[model samples]
Target: MPIVQCVPNFSEGRDLEKIEKIVQPLRCKEGVKLLNYEGDKNYNRLVVTVIGEPKKVKDAVLESIGVAAELIDMNNHKGQHPRFGATDVCPFIPIKDMTMDDAINLARELGKEVSERYGIPVFLYENAATKPERENLATVRKGEYEGLDEKFSDSNWAPDFGEAKKHSTAGAIAIGARRPLIAYNINLDTKNIEIASKIAKTIRHSSGGYRFIKAGAVEVSERNMTQVTMNLTDYTKTSMYRAFEAVKMEARRYGVNVMGSEIVGICPMEALIDVSAYYLGLENFDLSNVLETNLME
Candidate 1:
């Protein structure tokens, strides 16, 4: 009866046939619901969201990771997103009747199985990280795929599971347990990636921005625009509207227009409610005011 959500990011996005094949295991599986899966051609990445009974969800994700390992070749991979493996990063979050400890155990279980079965090295990150330095995903992915060999050479950079070496075609993966975070992106109506990058640096934590924000810039080539992509690690502390408004304020300095914004995967309803209250200038607004919130109960 324990519920958990798993979001597995794969390195392939352009090829629809392969994308479907990779996610086939999660589709129509008992005790598991495939909430959403999005493929971004520009980033060349697929983000899949699924929530279900903990064990069933784990099995489905493991099967899909195997499919990704066989189908995706990291040597021929290229994208604006930083990645080091076929199944780049997989994080498990406790949903219902579950605790963080349960999620961490599930992450360790999957990490070990994937490493032994597919020969892919795994790094436990975030709450499941063995070392303080490995807790931040950015630090874990610093060198990326190209620098994997050099990274493996250092004793301090050894993986949590499997050999110290990276897989030839599949590379390596980061499996972790963490609190839910929103992956949001704001688009700017300009092909100038520098402007987007500047805005990203201004609002990201690493550059003295918001404490719970991790951000970067990427080009949305097909749309002829640039995007300020971000992960709002704690919405309660740093809210979505605050990040959106900050980006708008910075973009105005460069005379750039806000194209729009998007949430990459599923997000808490409270996050959207906060945004609505801010934009509508509502007084003392909360989830209780929403009709659907009451109906669900």
Candidate 2:
């Protein structure tokens, strides 16, 4: 059996009821397993992890996106995260016995379905991008939700599927295939967002920082603090510990304390093992040493 993982991000995270409703399709479904879900109130987003057969996973994702489109009103939505639709970005990762090409095909299938059924413009990104410019998700979502109308008006920014105009309330969505990405955040003790933003700029790749890091700052209002939120695009190239240490060192310059850190949604155990080995100064740590790794094998 082939396995594909779908991590769909929705724009509504503050309301538990709405979040549950959006994820209902993945629960009790045949050939699909709901691995995990994490919601952040400050960012007003939900990240769901599900894996199963390619067709099953694809079906569940499309159903969930439909629920999200109906329940979420992007026009009135506000959060620290950059989003353009109810179901902001959906990425399919090839897991067991699946290749990158397989994931891209799944993405295109879902994109076509969502566009035709719901009238939501879908932009295929990452490995499934139709053009080189759309390969980067950030570039596809450059203007965010508020700027979608203007973005679509320009011929250069037309979506791969559906009409050029944005959905009335659901807005637009970005669907694609990509390697595993870690959504990591380092919280700062201070409430100043500027300090967090400055540190983010120093460590993100777009600003000439780490090669595989995409970072920004967000205000966690409930916690009354700011965080350097990041997406470790390729953890193998730029591990979590490296980003953590960089943020820690930068925060010290502004007299800010490193409160703590969090990993949103599911991450590969190897990513954590790498961080553990670095922090523990392990000379020869390997997966063979992990009990669970052996058990699985």
For model 2, give the 10-residue run with minimal summed lDDT: 288-297
Q: lDDT of all predictions, in order shown?
A: 0.95, 0.95
State which candidate has the highest lDDT.
1
Q: Per-residue alpha-carbon lDDT of model 1 for 141-170, expressed as tens digits?
A: 888888899999999999999999999999
Could you list the CA RMSD of all candidates, in the order they appear? 1.1, 1.1
| TM-score for each of the candidates | 0.98, 0.97
C-alpha RMSD (angstroms) for model 1 = 1.1
Give the per-residue lDDT of model 2 (tens digit) for 148-193.
Answer: 9999999999899999999999999999999999999999999999
- Runs off by more than 4 Å, candidate 1: 295-297
As for candidate 1, its clashing pairs are none
